[model samples]
Structures are given as structure tokens and as C-alpha cells.
Target: MRKSFCTTAILLAFGFVSSCGVAWSADAPLENSDCVKCHAKVVHENQADGGKHKTEVGCLDCHVGGHPPSTPKEDIIPQCSMCHSGEAHFELNNCLGCHQNPHQPLHIVFGDDNVAACNTCHPAQVNEIKDNPSAHGEFDCSLCHHDKHGYIPDCMECHEPHRPGQTYSDCITCHRVHQPTNVTYGQDIPNKDCGACHGDLMDTLAAGTTKHATLQCVYCHKDTHGYLPACQDCHGDPHPQLMMKKFMKCTDCHKDPHDLVK
Candidate 1:
């Protein structure tokens, strides 16, 4: 009986070893020591990358929580920032309010649907863009204003520094975001509205007697953007304006100077 029992025990031990060889292989798990040495700085560095963090936060930080971090997956690891509730910028509603992406979150893009958020930090710029028909449209304001707390980028900073030949700093002069029609100093103008800026020239025409008097100044002036009108555009007379020096401009003899003052 004793001999039979020994044989049965030997067979059972062999069966157990065979079963262990067939189990699923796990990924090369991270050793606990490998994670502890540089955990905090890794988080900071990860956040620095502009893309949604591919790995800003480590498993130990999220999965381990307040306790000393362990590599064991079963340790009480937290998954999202909301659990802390005391983290800086935490009150910003969802974890994404300021930290847009969890994997590589550093950019603070202004939410297009939430102007109130941008207003909290950049009220002045917000107003300029909102009130001006030519400023940034629904595109997120932070798309250009990349920094935090009202950080506006100079147009030349992101674009090539204005070349020496460039004459102006008014980026708005051409980059009308609301409607990007390339309005240089020479196009897309409204002449009737010229009176809005040049009241004196308009007065001279309202009192003229010629075909020019019949045609509103804007009819021929068209939209030179902001340039002055040239007589060469309608009347072939290069001398018409110079005539003011010798015979008086065409307007003096043909159009009214005031109230059609003939």
C-alpha cells in the first residue's frame, strides 16, 4: 500500500509542472524600481509636449494614488485628475478645462464655444476680436494667442519678422480674419463712404455742374481700399488735376464747389 501511494504522488507532481507551461504570457511588466526614480519630472516633461499627452502621467501616479507607488496593477490606482479635487486649476470644471489633453497637455487653446473662459483672463483682447468685424472669427482665440493669461503673440513673432522693406505694423491692415479679403491699400473700397473720412473733397463735388456731379464720387473712385482717387481712372486728363495750378481743376469750371454753386 505504501509503494502504491508514492507512485500516485510522483505522477501528480509531473502533471502540475506540465500545466504551468501552458499559461498565457504577460507583457514584460515594469519593475517597481524602474518607475520610482524619475516619476515626478516625467509628468512635467510629458505636459510640455503640445500634443495630447501620450504619456505625461505614469501608471504609478494614476494607479497607485497617495500611497507609495507600486507596480502591481492591483494597488488602488486612481485614473483621472478629478479624484484629487485639490490639484491646481482643478476648479476649472472637467480635467480638460486648462489641461486640454491628458497625454501631452501644455497648450491652453481658448474654447470657441466658451468665450467666458477666455474673457476671464484676456478680456481686452477678447473684446477687440469680438467687436471688430475684421478680427478672429469662431476659430479659437488661443490658436494664435498661444500663451496663458492674455498672452498675445505679436504678428511678427510667429510670422517672419517683418522684412526691412515692409512699411507697416498694422497686421489688421491686411489680415482681416472675420473676412479675409485681401484688401491692400488699393482695393475693395466704398467711395460714397469716402465722405466718412474726407468731408472737404465731398463738399466740392456736391456743388459741381458736370457729369461728375451727376455721378457719385464713389461710382468712379470704386474701392482703392484706402488710396486717394486718381483722375486718370475715369477722365484721360492727366492735366485735369494739374490744371488747378494753371486753369483750375475740372471741378472748378464744370462742377459745383458748394450747393452746385454755378
Candidate 2:
């Protein structure tokens, strides 16, 4: 009985020590050198252009548990959401489809339905499209940025220029493409671009001998498209207050700024 009790005690002590050894090995940090031996390509690619992943975390931080000869593939490979969560885009299950490599997350190639995911980072552009919608806003972001991120598509790809010599820059000068209808431009824009739509008005303004004919459309239109500036803004009370009372509207006497007879 005494020998049996001693044998039982030894087995229990051995089991306790074995368990401690396993726990210590599991808790130990992985050696980078060992990881690189098997995953040289992944490690190299990550080191080159891993963005925040390379700078912020080590391989073991993501890969977690045991490696080859011990851990299963399921145990070694981490889900993107394990570290990247909370954002609307991160909630998407198939991050690898566009991102391609976890090592280089920003090396993206857009896939179908991926354009909506852009709203996660570009809320301002999305909101601009939503609030002031146009034909451009109706289409997916990928339709314009088909190649990659930060690509600016030429307006001519989808629509003809407003005028003969108009370039892509000219289109954006007066039109916010995301909300194309909300046309606004700086003072530098020539009268010809505006004349594309207002041809009759342009012809009248050009034929007139008045000082208004000498100015650009932007001079009176000022900040944005379709803006009709008040005569008082430029010609402040041309007659007297009593004379102004008789002709409340500037057009009553001027006929029209575009066709001023005087």
C-alpha cells in the first residue's frame, strides 16, 4: 500500500510539471527568424509595403498560436476582422478579394460592389453626392475610378465637352462632378464656356456697345452658375432713390444687361 501511494504521488507530480512545461512553451513569443525561414515571401512583401501592419505589429501578433508541426492552418491564419473591426468596410467578410494580400492591405484592386466600401473613408465625397445628386452621383464610384484609388477620370470618357476646345479641367472648373448640377467656378473662366448653353444671350451681349459687353460672364454671374446679381451690387443707385422708386426693377429701364441699348 505504501509503494502504491508513492507511485500515485510521483505520477501526479509528473503530470503537474508536464502541464507547466506545455503552458510555458505556448506563452513564449515566436522568433521572427523561424517565421521568415518558412514565410520568406510573405515577410519580404510585408516589409516592403505592409503599411501600418509592418510598422505596428509582428507576425506572431497576428498568427497567434503554434506554428508548423503543431498548429493547424486554422489556428495560424487570422481573420482580417480579428484586428480590423468597427468600420463598415471591415465588416465585409471578403477583404482579401480586393486587398489581395493581408501583408499589403492598401495594394487594392477594386471588385464589383466595392465602390460603396469607399464611403468608409470618403464620407465627405459620399455625402456631397447624396445631398446634391447629379447623373455622376447616380453611378458607382468605380465607374469613374475603374483603375485604382486616387484616379481622376476624364469627363470626356462619359460626356462630350461643353465646347469645342474645352478640356477635362474646364469641366471641373465650373462643375463639381460628384454633384455636377451644382456648377460653380472662379473668376478666371472665359465667357465662351457659359456661352455653350446661353448662345442667344452671348450673341446679344457681344453685339451690344455697352460697357457690359466688355466684361466676362463671370464678372456679373460672380460665384456660381445661374446666379443673377443685383444691379445695385455693381451699379449702386445709378439714379436717385426717388428715381429708383419709380423703376423698382433694374430691367425696367436697362431692358436687359445682356442687351443694354444705352
In order, candidate lDDTs are 0.49, 0.78
Candidate 2 lDDT tens digits, 1-262: 3234324543664432333332224455456655554357899999999998888988878888765435666888888888888878787667888888889988988875755688878988988888996877777888899848788889898798877989988888888888888778899988888899989888899999999999999999988777889878987876878887877688887799999966
- What would the TM-scores of all predictions be? 0.31, 0.73
Residues 104-126 of candidate 1: C-alpha lDDT, one tens digit per residue: 55555545455566555557766
In terms of TM-score, the best-performing candidate is 2
Residue runs of model 2 more than 4 Å from their true location after superposition: 1-30, 86-89, 229-256
Top candidate by lDDT: 2
The lowest-lDDT stretch of 10 consecutive residues in candidate 2 is 15-24
- Residue-level lDDT for 50 in candidate 2: 94
Candidate 1: clashing residue pairs, number: 12
